[model samples]
Target: MALPDPNTSWPPKPWDEAYKVYAESETWRVGDADAIHEFYRGERPAATHRRDGELYEGGVVGWVSSKFWGRPVPPGQNRTRLHVPAPADVASLASASVFSNPPELRFTDKQSKNTIDRLELIGNSDQAHSTFNTMGELKSVFGASVLVSEWDTEIADHVWLSAYGADVALPEFRKGKLVAVTLWTEYRDGNEYYRHLERHAVGAIEHALYLGTADKIGQRIPLQDRDETAYLATLVNENSVILTGIDRLTASYNMNLPTWAWRKKGALANAGRSDFAQLYPLFDALDEAYSSWMRDLKLGAAKAVVPQAFLETLGRGRGASFDIDRELFVGLNTPGNPDGDKIEQVQFEIRTEEHEATTTELWRMIYRTAGLGTRSVDKDTGRQLTATGELLQDDDKEATRGKKILYDKRAIAEQLAVALELDGKLFAGKGGGQFAPPEVRFPDSAQVDPEKQARTIQYLSAAGAISVWQSVKMFNPDWDDTAVGAEVNRILAEKRAAAAMVPDPATFDGGDPTQDPNNPDNQGGNPDGGQ
Candidate 1:
């Protein structure tokens, strides 16, 4: 579909629902306490239960606050509604697991590869590689991310790509391939929202500026009204379309993982699934467990209950506090009491063991549900393992990383292909040609034991379980067939050269120098023995 009609309702039903899902993931990913509490409360406005003439906020949101209190906590109370940000942590872990070492991009044609290399140098500061890392995190969070390649003569001669989260992306896919997309940026100015929507198609990109409110799309306004898009008015034609000299869509849709579990059914049923999906409840529980522990710590602090004489007064209207360091106290006795009032210490026992077990269990569930194995965290110490740390690459984490890599490889290939085409067309004198999708290769997970792997490969090669070339390929996963073959031939040639260095016994007069007849010492040895 072309640009939506000016007055039409914004974000059609599918997109609206998709955005809601994105919003939920985003709230957890951001881990904003207010946003989390507000989103959950708004999500279930009627999620309130009445008990003993009091209404309490229900569900995990309220549970975070009232779990320890055993009642609804007032706004100003000492309730600790701590948010763990497990969603953010999980997404980041997923991204780091896949992108700690960015993928190496190689083109089939030498010129195409060189052109891309030059474009990357001049386009932005390692634009494609760095953007891939960013997109990985976003794909993990939003389940999908969009990559759009474009060129601006005013900015630079090379083509650049932009990555956007699913929240701002309105993608149109055909047969599992993205053919068109409309990416927009919105900012609130005072009470109204200003939006700039850029639609990318095969040959043309349309730009539209809208003056909207908080919930309404308002109307389409002239591009001149918005400074960000004002330049488009001069570059675009009457319909605000810029003719990009490319055959394929410049935008590529990258999914984190494919599944039929997208909230919106029908055509989009197989869309990408977020890494945080099905893990929100676990996230909430994790936060609740942590907050409850913190509350216990606060409530369990030791207190001294002293008599009224030990109190210190600030002012007439101010409250008083019992200070044990007062150092001065007057002796007093009640009329009917023989002993004076005494100070007593009071303390509550903190359930440290219970809280630790609960939070640890919750973290394990989060790691497993997020497709990261329990090894993602050190259960004993409760420390999250970094990507570069000693993470045991279990079957589940490896499979999930593999799936994410698969999606990343396809998206990167398509985006780079389109980028190359545009680079050639937009810059006529620059390098250009018919290029197929480049061979994309990703490296192994960061924490893999390379020495162990090398030893295994060596043992296999020695046992004839695998060929030399196969061993080389296994050692270098990012290498293409040609590169692997070249390395294998080099190894074999070195082996042959080493074999030629050994002496041939058939050509030698004597195998041992001490027994050679030509040696004077050997000839004299017989004479000395005879004497």
Candidate 2:
């Protein structure tokens, strides 16, 4: 390692140059720690603190500019760490999470250069989560931590039904009960929990939209009883889509997602994997039927969901019109004493054509209801805001971009199978590049083992499939949802419903009706005179 060059302008003239040099060497760190500055700055959460400035808003893809909440290392002191100051107050988040008009944002300006990449934030529980693994390269962000527990209802945050017959609707049918699911996060003093009800439907689907908005993204984990393989096969067997590439479709297999109407055939019944598999298809169908314009607003005023606002206002056009009630747009908690533009007077109205589906508006409700946006406030000034509603998009994109991952294991087997048929040529055991690539449309179970299929292309690149496909795969990891997981949940939701149906099998004794066949059966099967 070269010794520090004292004569070379001490610590390099421009701070960036010095930072760059330090970054390449072991000496760099975010904070003054000499050994790990690079990791500090590099691994550090994107510092979200920003000043009161014009924010980037209202365009298909526009730039956001704001002030920098930075902790520049002292010259000789040697600290380059980047961090979001801790949040002490709850209202602080609502206050700090600001969307201002961009004030002469210039790339050259450090503060302006810190424009947010993209936005998405969900749930109050994340604040309770102790880890800062939201970092893109880290797995812990969405990864799970399992806890062993006794089968007690009082302990679980959410409830999951294991039986209810894999094909049955939740509680609507006497036999087909719901498979309950629970998600719990232990906090310092208590825990935060979310429970989900599963529903399903059966269909031969050719194409399905990926779960687009953020609210539904991370909730795809399956229930214990449903086989992941069966769920995926059903999705592809019924609905198949073959893509040529580039935001364009080459072919759709069986049929397309039911557009603009109730699917009398019920596309989601028995569709996904597991006891709770049906949930996604129902939501997707709902998103579609309502033209993504469900009456329930996905976003609320407090959420300050930018994309919802942006899409509702304009999917990037100056004159796009919509027909949602303007009343729904009122009463977002306004910021008090805002240091910047004081959008305390925030007001907006959208114009939509007579015929365009309320698709964009649909997402807004999903965004708001799912808690897609909100942020933490600056500790010192309390005026600085953190961009939350938007899940840092670019980073999520970069984190796993074509990040070679498993679709299922047998993809390699298929390649080898094809190879053997051609007289035993060796497979390089690699795929997913500009030339030879893995087929992304979840292959059918008969085509290949769904488990192995899930493992195959999944091995090459997780994010590389047509970028559009990510949404589809992101929510429907098992490839599709089930009607049971979709509808049953909505049916037998109340816990008490379980008691109304299943009698205690332990006490179900002493009844042999089969032998008597109604004592009138005495005439047919009597011991005295058999007819």
The candidate scoring highest on lDDT is 1
lDDT, each prediction: 0.77, 0.25
Q: Candidate 2 lDDT, tens digit per residue, 277-332? A: 12222223332334222222232123232322322454555655434344444323
Those runs of model 1 whose alpha carbons end farther than 4 Å from true positions after fitting are 46-72, 110-116, 119-125, 312-319, 334-340, 379-393, 450-531
Give a tens-digit lDDT track for model 1, residues 1-531: 677776666776567877888888888888888787777656544546656656545564465453222234555566688888788889888888888777777666556545766545533256677787789899999988997786788889887777889888888877766778899999679988888999988888989888877767788889999778888899999888998866888898898887556635754664588988888778878888999898889889998777776677887999888766766777477778644567778999899999988988888888888888776367466665564453353667888999888888888888777787777777776766556877787877745557667878978978989999999988887799999999999999999999799777778664676667787767755644553
Question: TM per model?
Answer: 0.79, 0.15
The TM-score measured for candidate 1 stands at 0.79
In Å, residue 324's CA in model 2 sits off its true spot by: 33
What's the lDDT for residue 254 in model 2? 13
Off by over 4 Å in 2: 1-358, 364-391, 394-404, 408-410, 417-422, 425-531
